[model samples]
Target: MTLAIPDLPAVLETDRLIIRSPQPGDGPDLFDAVVDALADLRQFPASLPWAMEMPSVDESESFCVAGSESFQARKDFPFLFIDKTSRIVVGAGGLHRPRWTVPAFELGFWGRSSFVGRGLFSEAADALVNFAFASFDAKRVEAICDDLNVRSIRVCERIGMQLEGVLRQERRAPDGSLRNTRIYSKCE
Candidate 1:
């Protein structure tokens, strides 16, 4: 079952980017970002499920619909990352909840191929972490990245998340190989 989070302001403008709730109209743009970023994203096992299936516009629409509902239910909030200058959806970011652990949440994010190495992910992450702590009064915010995804690991570290530990072979990549997951966290 999918969970929902309360909807907030439609757009969150950073100095260089706008983070906002995605609309059905954003389906095609988001789909393109996902496809374009596939190779870079495949490095992270968390996104392995979508690596093979290049989603259609309908599938992307379903994603936005689910995201909208999830926001309304106070479950999770998935926002499209838009470049302020271009006003284009360049990536995605959000929070995830494990029902067993209410109130505390996990952070998830990914950027398009062109957005990498530009530090937007870290900026967006810091914003989301701040939101989780302030808006939700969350006791803890966490993130996990594949060991091989050095860029993501660096993003997490850049945002002040401490390396808690590494879970050896906890995840299997799309390539059918076991991989280590680096766990990181920031506390309230």
Candidate 2:
């Protein structure tokens, strides 16, 4: 069964991070993080189309506001990952594309370039996966990424998600070339 939005925890804590839903004032920090990681994000245009263009601070704020609304409506669960000690937004990720009927969710994540190689994204992602299973009673949690994204693949494997398969020519890359997609999942 699907849990009501009110029943969902808006903030989830880890030993070193605070994973929470986006709020109105989060735009500045979110903008900085996105800009810092823009080049890296642009590498997978098909997977991260939103990163193709630089968004204004207002646009980022709009995203936060809309994200909050989506969270409240139970349509999506976008989150910001903040460092516990520094209180800085280190990354962003969440369970998206929910299929409440089967109680499944698609996990997605990305870290600021400065925070890369720190394992913070992995920590946040693990917490999200656990939250999906525990809080949402999700029967299946999956992550799909560009086949060439080694870091993302490692994150999925590190969190014990098994590689289901790769979909050849699943989509087109930014350069108009065929791209493969790797699907990973942890199922009940």
Candidate 3:
């Protein structure tokens, strides 16, 4: 059975960040961020294909609209994480691709190249995980990452999501090679 949307605040604030839904005019800000982080993002070939080339402003706005619509529909929970003080959109992360039948959401994230060393994504993940459980009564929150992505694995671990197992040769990599996926989950 699909779970109904739960009541929650539109914006969530952590000590150093503010997490919120994507807005209509976020295209330019998003365009700048991806442009700034393109090199770093390209490292994960399968993460975002659009990052291969810079998107036009219209493309970015369309992405924002889609995210906003899905969020409003309670189909996916998306968030943009900004530095509370600097107000820079340092990173984006979300509880996405949810299976409300199982009440599980997959976590994914990315940070601007300049913010990688910092723990902003980790902080935001923590907040989102908390909200997912407290607000949505999720039975499981999981993160699936390429087995080779040590950085992503670390983020999942940092948030206390236990390694469930590895799915061998389950996906095709960005370079056309078969890739393994590491599954991590926090269960209620």
Candidate 4:
């Protein structure tokens, strides 16, 4: 069964980061982070279609507003990862594609270019996994990424997610070539 929105915490904290639902004024920070990481994000265009074009400030604002609405509606949970020390948005990610019947969630994340080498993304992902299990009683949490995304694979592995399988030729890459997808999961 789906849990009430009020039962979920608006903010999830890790040792060095704060993962929180998008708020109205978060657009500028989000935009900065996205732009800083645009090249890396666009490398997997099919999986990140939104990164194909540069986003305007207004578009970013709208995205944040929609994220807030979606969170309230229990449609999706999009979050921004903020560094506790610098108070900068280091990345954005969330548990999406909810399967309430099975109590499952798909975790996704991307870090700002400047923050790519840090362990913050992995920390945030681990926290999200715990939140899904503890708050939603989720039976499973999964992460899917392009097979060539080594960084993402490392993040999944670092968080103790097991590689379930690789879906061969699952979709097309930006260059019109077949792309494989790696599926990783952590079960409660």
lDDT of each: 0.80, 0.93, 0.83, 0.92
Identify the runs in model 4 with alpha carbons over 4 angstroms from their true place: 1-6
**Superposition error at 47 for model 1 (Å):** 5.1
1-188, model 2: which lDDT tens digit per residue? 64464488768999999999999999999998999889998999889899999999999999999999999888999999999999989889988999988889999999899999988988999999999999888999999999999999999999999999999999897799888999999998
lDDT of predicted model 1: 0.80
Cα deviation of 156, candidate 4, in Å: 0.2
TM-score of each: 0.90, 0.96, 0.92, 0.96
lDDT of 1 by residue, 11-39 (tens): 67777888877776778888888887888
- For candidate 2, which ten residues in a row score worst on lDDT? 1-10
- 3 against 4, candidate with superior lDDT: 4
lDDT by residue (1-188, candidate 3, tens digit) is 53567676989999999999888888777777777788977766654566677788889888878889988888887888889998888878799988878788988787788888688888988888888898888899998887887878888899999999999988775689887888999999
Give per-model CA RMSD.
Answer: 3.1, 1.4, 1.6, 1.3
Q: Where does the lowest 10-residue lDDT sum fall in candidate 1? A: 1-10
Q: At residue 183, what lDDT does model 3 achieve?
A: 92
Backbone clash numbers for all candidates listed: 8, 0, 0, 0
